[model samples]
Target: MHVTAILSHADEGGFTAFNPETGTATQGETLDEALANLREAVELYLEEFPMATRAAPFVTSFDVAVHA
Candidate 1:
């Protein structure tokens, strides 16, 4: 499944996680590292959530636009 992750670092230096498909967002010290952690999170979510066989998991695709 394709998932979109947005990461931000807290003032104290920690990571946050969110799913674009679910319109959720989180934070991390670094985007790349946060994304990697989020990958594991999604898998764990799936394992915990459970679903029917042959049922495709939801895919989340996203784009980040910054206005300057």
Candidate 2:
């Protein structure tokens, strides 16, 4: 099944990966490793609690105004 992954830089080090579809998260030293870890985590979650058919997530970004 196809899923969405959101990655971000960790404060301590490395990267953190998150899968919104399954609400799974993992961390790794690199982007590739983070994705791999996220994949494995999502697989395990699905094995235990399978999900029904759903549409793919629409990812976008918006700007917010910052006041000084």
Best by lDDT: 2
Lowest summed lDDT window (length 10), candidate 2: 52-61
Q: TM-score, each model?
A: 0.49, 0.90
For residue 2, give model 2's deviation from the true position in Å. 1.5
RMSD of model 2 against the true structure: 1.1
Whole-model Cα lDDT per candidate? 0.65, 0.93
- Expressed as tens digits, the lDDT of each residue in 1-62 for candidate 1 is 55556565666787777865444454557777677777776777777775344544556568
Clash number by candidate, in order: 4, 0
For model 1, give the RMSD to the true fold.
Answer: 5.6
